[model samples]
Target: MDVLTAIRGRRSIRSFKGDEIEPEKIEVLKDALVWAPSAGNLQSRFFYFVYNDDVKRRLVGAALGQGFILEAPLVVVGCADIRRIAVRYRERGVYLYCIEDLACSIQNMMLAAYSEGLGSVWVGAFHENEVAGILEMPENHRPLAIVPVGYPDEDPVPPERVAHKDTVKEVF
Candidate 1:
């Protein structure tokens, strides 16, 4: 599918079927993450693909009982490696660039999942410290997003968006 079509059609899917994602499709998602443009090309991001039921349950708790997390076949925990980016850019890198890098990678993964006939939701309402502890993340890695992926069980309507005239501005 075309990029615009993918961008327009993709929805935040919360419900999912029980089917396992194909290995090839998972590889595509992985590729999408690594290939995303990074700040300073430091690639200050890491991800954990969780399939274990026990781990998913723990994540659900960390996510404030977002039960759908346990329903999806895979959960991807996106993290920003602060130490990696801070080596050169210092405080700004730690607080901003690393986050931007991780956000780009997470967006790429979501788009790739949609292109591969999978569904996912970018969940950010979780307890970050709890998630980090649950995943046994390194001190330098900070969890940012929790994405649950699988075949969609429900078709969500397109959410409304702000009109360009209202949300965008031209300074020049």
Candidate 2:
């Protein structure tokens, strides 16, 4: 599918079927993430693909009982490698660039997943520290997004959006 079509058709799927994702498609998702443009090429992002049921349950708890996390066949936890970027960019890197890098990678993965006939949701309302602890993340890495992926169980309609005139600005 075209890029615009993928962007317009992709939905924040919360319900999922029990089918497992194909290994090649999972590889495509991973490739999409690593190939995303990073701040200064620091590539200060990390991910954990969780397939264990026990870990998914713990993640659900960390995500404030978003039980759909456990239902999905895969859960990808996106993290920012702060120290990697901070070595050169320092404070700004720690505060912003690392996050931007992770965000870009996550967006790439989500779009790739959609194009591969999978569904996912970007879940950010979670306990960060708890997620770090649960995943045994290193000190330099910080969890930023929790994405659950699988075949969609429900087909939701497109959500409302503000008009470009209301949100966009033209500045010369």
Candidate 3:
């Protein structure tokens, strides 16, 4: 699918089919993340690809109760190594930019999933420390989002978009 079509068609899919996702499609999503723009190209993002049923269950049980997480064969936990970014960009005010860069990487991954005919959702309302413990991430790594990817089982109607006249503004 084209970029614009993917962007418009993509939705936060919370339900997934039992079918497993192919390894090649997972690779495509990861490759897209690698190409995501990073602050100063530091590439502070790190991904923990979880496929084990037990670990995925733990993740679903603790941080997220979303059963789709367990149904999906692949769940990618996005993490940001702030210490690495801090080392490279010690200058003040750069930490926020590094975080923004991490967000960009996640967005790219989501869009790529949509383009590949897969479904995923950006899950942020979860316990970070619990997820870190489940994933066994280092102290310096911050869990940003949980993306459960698989074939869509349910279709969600598109939510209304904000009108340009009310949301956009121009200042000459």
Regions of model 3 farther than 4 Å from truth: 91-95
Which predicted model would earn the best lDDT? 2
Q: After superposition, how far is residue 87 of candidate 1 from its true place, in Å?
A: 0.3
lDDT of 3 by residue, 7-104 (tens): 89999998888888888998999898899998778888799999999998988876658777888878989988777788867744245866787789
Candidate 3, after superposition: displacement of residue 128 in Å? Answer: 0.9
lDDT of each: 0.95, 0.96, 0.85
C-alpha RMSD in Å of predicted model 2 compared with the true structure = 0.6
User: Residue by residue across 1-172, what tens digits does model 1's lDDT show?
Assistant: 8889889989999999999999999999999999999988999999999999999999999999999999999999999999999999999999999999999999999999999999999999999999999999999999999999999999998999999999889898
lDDT score for candidate 2 against the true structure: 0.96
Number of clashes in every candidate structure? 0, 0, 0
What does candidate 3 score on TM? Answer: 0.93
Residue pairs with backbone overlap in model 3 = none
Please give the distance, in angstroms, between residue 8's alpha carbon in candidate 2 and its true position after superposition.
Answer: 0.6
For model 2, state the Cα shift of residue 87 in Å. 0.4
Query: What TM-score does candidate 1 reach?
Result: 0.98
